[model samples]
Target chain A: MDQILTNALGELLTPMTAAYALAAIGLAMHFGFTGLLNFGQAAYMLVGAYAFAMSTLAGLGLIPAILISFAASIVLSFILGIPTLRLRSDYLAIVTIAAAEIMRFIVSTTGLNDVTGGPQGLSGFARDFYAINPFPAGEYGFWAWTMDEKGLWVRVVAWSLVIIAALFVAKMIRSPWGRVIKGIREDEDAVRSLGKNVYSYKMQSLIIGGMLGTLAGIVFVLPRAVQPGNFGTGLTFFIWTILLLGGAATVLGPIIGSMIFWVLLSLTDGLLSAGVDSGVITFITQNQIGGIRFMLVGLGLMLLVIFRPQGIFGNKKELYFNG
Target chain B: MANEIAKGKAEPGCAKVDPILVADNVVRQFGGLTAVDVKHVEIPRGQITALIGPNGAGKTTFFNLLTGFDKPNSGNWVFNGKELAGVPSFKVARLGMVRTFQLTKALSLLTVMENMRLGYQNQKGENPLAAMFRSVWKKQEQVITETANELLVRFKLDAKKDDFAASLSGGQRKLLEMARALMTKPTMIMLDEPMAGVNPALTQSLLDHIKDLKKEGMTVLFVEHDMHMVRHISDWVIVMAEGKIVAEGPPKEVMKNPAVIDAYLGAHHDSDLGSKKKAGK
Candidate 1:
């Protein structure tokens, strides 16, 4: 029981939690701020991860590889936005999910095995990134919370990026450009009548959000190998859960939401596993734990939708999911 | 046509004064139905010209075409002598023409002050890159806030500056919409049913604001159904029926025309004329 508590608490500082928080913040910008239903956000992460891996594998430096990945995300945003932004919100949702699936298939195809490593994925790209880490080589933690040098470095970088990105987004939403995008979310015709190029604004919003997702992708792969299967539709769903668990529009919602999500997930997994091992319950096997945990999260989400549709921090009046 | 007889013009096309807006042979159709089919119409510069029609007469549709909110099926139009065919609505607004919708389009979630601030054009803070830095547009934002506050005061919505626009009353929304439109400092203002849903007590104030647009050297074109308000404020009136301009003249002259009365009251034109005459006097 003590180990379970420690493990759940430690999960909060992991790079995966920070990555999900970053991606959720980007998703908030798309759905909450701009009212865009971009269901292919996982595709952006795939592109970013693959682009970074391929560039670094081809002997590019860290800065060039990161820049290349960001550029690829922008290109992907334009490709997705041009055909769908002019249509209704449902079309974007449909196209994005399809595009993300297509991207996953393309990266895992046998033909791209040399570059993407097919299902096995690419590794050894993070060595260059970790080489510049300022943290000294040693275990660092207080009591049950602990991490090695590499783990500490990745967490430090990932969480720092998340904080900076959150601050940037919080400020952006308060500016005139932010107001215009919010107005576009409300009614594009009203914004257009005010002499704002609505299409351009939507495209800009798509690119900015996509780039944030790309950065999240980089952070996600820093502590692990670049696995193509990781950027599946499930990833997008997880980000969505995190976004809604907090407030979709508020800055701190995604961060706090991500932490809570991981903590709950880990807590459930630890409790169920412990219950099975100790023979306290025998109705379900160990194999069913993962599914049951997800079921609990889904139930929580359903309850949130019924009672607090605006999430924890969101204002009820600002809740406009229909764009 | 009887419309030509009232105006005493062989051809009812261009205004006698310099025109700010000119549309020729503009037509819009919805499936088999023709929505708007204006042969020719010119709105005079620096004057409040009222576009009046019975229900389903395409006055709002015409306003939509002229303001670039909707495209015409055929023909072209010009604003300030510049051809505006195929121009987008925002571009048209940037070119000094702006419009308000029949159902008020106040961003309900935004505060009244934020809605007003959105009307100002060409703010450096509106640029995505520049917006991240407050220093880039802080002073301009301050200036815009001052201007927005002043407009709110003038429109008697100053007390509700921090309140969400959704909380405003119907008449207050109309006032806010009009006030927001003025934030653009438009050269030409087109209002669609500015009096609709407004209380009778606020109608006179709305009319005065329309007149004040002309006084400020801004050309105003508005669609209105209230004949009394039309005659009281409009310098020129154009009447449409069945997607065609049937009459054009000063309000009193247009009201006296048989073509205008027939289109509005159908076969009971005589009784409507008597009431109109009494109201006009």
Candidate 2:
């Protein structure tokens, strides 16, 4: 029982949790504050992961690779935003869903095998990042939380970025600039009549949110590999689930929401597998554990929406369903 | 005020004594329907001009065209001596002509104060980078807030300053929209059916507020369906039918025009509805 509990708690420190939290913040910006229907946040993540990895392979070093990934996310945001931002909000949702899928298929195609490694994906790009690790060549943490030097380094970097991003987004939503963005969220025509360049503000918002997704993508691959299969419509939907689970619009919602989602996921995984191994659960095999866990997550999300649509941190009076 | 507004006899497509807005050959067509087609029209400066018509008379369409909310198929308009043929709505607003929607857009999630502050153009802190630093726009933000507070008080919305605009009553939302427009310090204002959903008690105050706008030296042009409102407050009135300006004159004169009556009622209003009319008659 203690092992199961510790294992679930360990999910809180995983780089994947940090990535989901980071990308969900970007979704909060797009859907929560600005009223942008950006369903392809995973596209930005894919762009970031691929750009950072490819640039690193090209010998651009760490900082330059990060910058290159940011540039790539900006470009992708433009490609997604320029035509659809001016139209109805639904157009963006439609475009993004399709765009993310197409990009995934393109990346996975054998045509780009040499550059993107096709289905196999890329690795060895983390060397430069791990090279700068200052935690020394020894294990760290206490009890079940113990990790090598690189694990600690990536955790510190990922959570640091998350903190910076949260602070930045919090400060922005309280500023005059955020006022206009919120106004656009309510009514673009209303904002336009007030002498605001609504299109420009929307574009700016898209770029900012996309950059966060890109950064999350980099952190996502820091302890793993840059795999095209990781960024799909499923990934985008998961980020959304995290965003809504935490609460939309508020900065802290995604961070805490991601933590809860991962913990529950790993907890259910541990419990179900233990049940299977002990022969206490004869209905499902070990291979079906992953699918059952996801089903449980879906059930939990539906319950959350039905009971608390405003989410945990959200004000009960200010329901997110207004838009 | 009515006598001084027109240079020639007050008629459809006539010249104004001092035109603040002039349009020539503005046309808008939606498939088989020609929604609006005005050869010439001019809005007089520093006066209350009411655009009135029955439903489907294209009053709102013309308003949308003049304010740059919708594009015309042909022709151009000049506002405050600047050609606004292809200018975007925001630039048109920045050029001192602002308009309110028929359906009041109160920006529901925003606080009443935030909605009011959004009316101020060109805030330094509106820039994304500049917004990160409080010192950059802190002083100006305070000033803007002060201005917004004054407007709120004038509009009797001071009590709800921090409340979300969605919480306001329908009449209050209309007032909020008008007050927000005033935040731009516009040279001219256009209101589209400001009294549509408002209750009778608020009607008189809304009228008084509009009259107050004229006293403040701002050009006021509004679209209203209530003939009583057109007669009570408008210095001049322009009537439309079938996407054409059918009559234009001082409110009293235009109200009495035969064309105006023909437009409101059918051409054979004199004939009883039960009596069938001859097609060629």
Instruction: Return the top candidate by DockQ.
Output: 2
lDDT of 2 at B115: 96
lDDT of 1 by residue, A193-269 (tens): 99999999999999998998999999999888999889899999999988988988888999999999999999999
Candidate 2: which stretches are off by over 4 Å? A320-323, B271-281
Model 1, B42-97: lDDT tens digits are 88788788899899999999889888888999989999978998898999999999
List, residue by residue over B36-62, the lDDT tens digit for candidate 2: 989899999999999998899999999
Predictions in order: lDDT: 0.88, 0.92
Residue B162 in candidate 1, Cα distance off native in Å: 0.6
Q: Give interface RMSD, every candidate, in order.
A: 2.2, 1.3
